[model samples]
Target: MNLMFVHDVRSETYNEETFARSYGYKIWEERYLPVFNKINVCFRNKDTNVDLNGISDKSSGPKVFFDKRIGMFKGPDVFFSRRIKNILRENIRNNDAVIVRLDSFLGLQTISECRKINKPYMIELVGCAWDSFWNHGFLGKILAPYLFLKTKIEVKRAPFVVYVTREFLQKRYPTKGISTNISNVKISKQKESDLNGRIEKISRLGNKIILGTAANVDVKYKGQKFVIEALGRLKKQGYTQFEYQILGPGDQRYLLDMARKFGVENQIKLLGSYPHEKVFEWMRNELDVYIQPSLQEGLPRAVIEAMSLGVPCIGSDVAGIPELLDKKWVFSRKKDKANEISKLLKKISKEELKVQAIRNFKTAEEYDYNFLLDKRFKILEKYKDFIRREK
Candidate 1:
């Protein structure tokens, strides 16, 4: 059986010969390949102005393909082009199932066509559509409420739904269909998470405190901006004992400008995005604190992994973030997140940091890669059974 996976995550071409993805297709292939004979990863291409310089993955085998032969313009532009319509239509008609990663424009279009053609379909809700659009700057602000409602309506009618968050997304976009919650994060048993070493890092806090997060520098919603603002706030309060680092790929010009305004430009470092395998090593050896300052999120895998590595962490309390954090560590509002993050920095102590390190590692223990993969497979198996019956 062939599975069609439709999501709005845009793709970029580095050399024009192949497409690269920041999030990569390898993770999706790993999840779906076991359940189907083949999987078609149908994603959008980037807009003309924005580019992230993405890395490529060598995941395609005899069983799967990146079928972008479905021409460009994945929007109302589809109405103007016959070529775009036919390729998309054939992919839908030939595939045994369509998995729409919801609340995205491309996913909406894919689902609309699936319903019209009476094809078997399923939903995988990853994050809040409302937050995604609302935090997405000007164009997104205007579309936020409308998109949120549109996504909510479709989710309610979906026949099978999988949520990355257990509570937050379900409350916002409830589905009447058979449903399950399985986070996309996958940490493994073989990897070492040094809780004792983390305790020692906190012990060495007599020196400068190093705070780090993983997010693209240019993306405002990733919430690194607030961390910069908070760093500035701390500087004003005469706490120069701090260094902030971001590990993700993007143009850092805006961030540098923001840091300069706060007079803390020298304290911030931008480490370009690293391969997933190498980043954990960085996290384990380098970080004193891991902060997920996202304006919105599903269960953030970075925070969970930081926890697994016994890194003391804090985040803006949005989406599934609160589910993973203690109430005391979470900041409730975006407008006040800078102030909130500043407050947490002010009060951080050796005892509290060690306690959190131990606590977070214990909680993150449940997310080992093999354990979550089994849960994901169970729901997919149920979905495959549904597809067989539909035929």
Candidate 2:
């Protein structure tokens, strides 16, 4: 059967020859290719600068196809034109099934078009629109409640819903329709010796402790700032053996400036984004602890990946973070996350780190690739069955 997947995710094209996504392109083939014979993705075009160098990991081999005409239109930041709406109408009319991701301008608009023609579609609820917008800054604070309500109403009426977060997004945006909680994290089993290596690393972590987080520094809600602030608090209390490594794409000037103000400038290392293999290698070799200090999240893939590596992790209490970690390992979601992080980092012992590593690796077993694949396969099978009956 054919599928038309709708999302507002940004993607770039190479002269309409090859395509790439900010999220890896392999995700398409991995998730949809099993049940869907042919998949046509309808997503917003990436209008910003399309750098050619080192784009292979993203553009490697995307099996999904796209409509070049749809790619020509402006993205969600701009107004949706009538011509685009007409194109989407025709696109939906041709496909057997439509899966629209929620909490995006284009996705909501597509839902409107689907409903107008009495078309049946499914929803993918990944994150809370409320936390996303409220933490985005001034104008976002004003629009947060509106978008949150809009998303809630949309999810409430959808015929089928898939939530990435097990509990967080499910509670925030519920549905009376058929729904399932499935996280997007995929991890591989670690060797038993990997835990021994973590314990060995902690034994040697006497004077210096290496900490790291992977996220775009440009997005404030990722909570990179809080880590720096927590380090600052540690410094003020005469603790200065911590080093922070950041890995992701974004302007680091803000974080750098904050690092300097916090008097931990020398401790900060902004290692730009690397391929998945390289990232895992870095975590295994260099990191003493992994931190996901995000103010919001959807069961962050990074944390689970870290867990798979036997790296002790700390995350904010919001969303699915607490679900991944124990209460003591997580800081509160309030404004003083830095304080809570500071206290946790200060009091957490090496023995506790060793214990966390062992426990975390065990927890990660549930997200093993084969296990998740079987789970998602069943979900997609249900989706296909439901769509065929409705259409």
Model 2 agreement with the true structure over 114-154: per-residue lDDT tens digits: 89988888888877888888998887798788888988999
lDDT by residue (231-269, candidate 1, tens digit) is 999988898888998988679899989989888989999
* Clashing residue pairs found in predicted model 2: none
Worst 10 residues of 2 by lDDT: 71-80
Stretches of model 2 off by over 4 angstroms after superposition = 15-22, 47-56, 59-62, 67-80
Compare the candidates by lDDT and give the number of the best one.
Answer: 2
Give the clashing pairs for model 1: 187-369
TM-score of 1: 0.91
Task: Looking at model 1, report the run of 10 residues with the lowest lDDT sum.
Answer: 50-59
How many pairs of residues collide in model 2? Answer: 0
- Report every candidate's CA lDDT: 0.79, 0.80
What TM-score would you give candidate 2 relative to the actual structure?
Answer: 0.91
